[model samples]
Target: MTERPSLKEMRAKALKNPEVKAEYDALASAFEMKRQMIALRKAAGLTQEEMAEKLGTKRSNISRLESMSASNSPSIATIENYARVLGYSLRVGFEPAAAR
Candidate 1:
């Protein structure tokens, strides 16, 4: 049997398609946000359960907040609360979009 392609290889191939690349680009910010949330939680040494307790929410809710495919986008207040629970203050800013 042949070895399967690695995820990186498969992703590179998939991203070759213009439509798939566009969709991926569209979701890049959301993906980056989720990644940063997970990193912050890890840096705070908090499990999902612990984070939920601090946030007065459920573990599942914390999981959803860190999930890339979460159906509802979290509001600024929600993000602020998450950061506050991790002993951080949230900051939001904007920069000019890069030319495509």
Candidate 2:
């Protein structure tokens, strides 16, 4: 049997490509945002279906929002709705861009 490369190893290899590294860095914050949203929903003891019902949408929609693709950005109003149902609020801010 062969051992598979670990994620850390794979990431290091991928990041060696300048274009891949740039894309990965661009997506880091988006990935973190989804993780935080999922964490908040879990912390509130809400399943996708339960949260969807509260938000008056389909469970699949909530799933899609939580697993958004690079091309599928959620609207501010939609995000606000999610936060409202989750007993949370949404805040937006900007940070300095990371050095290349």
Give per-model CA RMSD: 1.3, 1.5
lDDT value, candidate 1, whole model: 0.91
* Candidate 2 lDDT over residue span 1-100, tens digit each: 9999999999899999999989988888889889989999999999999999999999989999999474589999998888888888999999998776
Where model 2 places Cα greater than 4 Å from the true spot, the runs are none
Off by over 4 Å in 1: 98-100
Per-model C-alpha lDDT, please?
Answer: 0.91, 0.90
What's the TM-score of each model vs. the native?
0.91, 0.89
Clashing pairs in 1: none
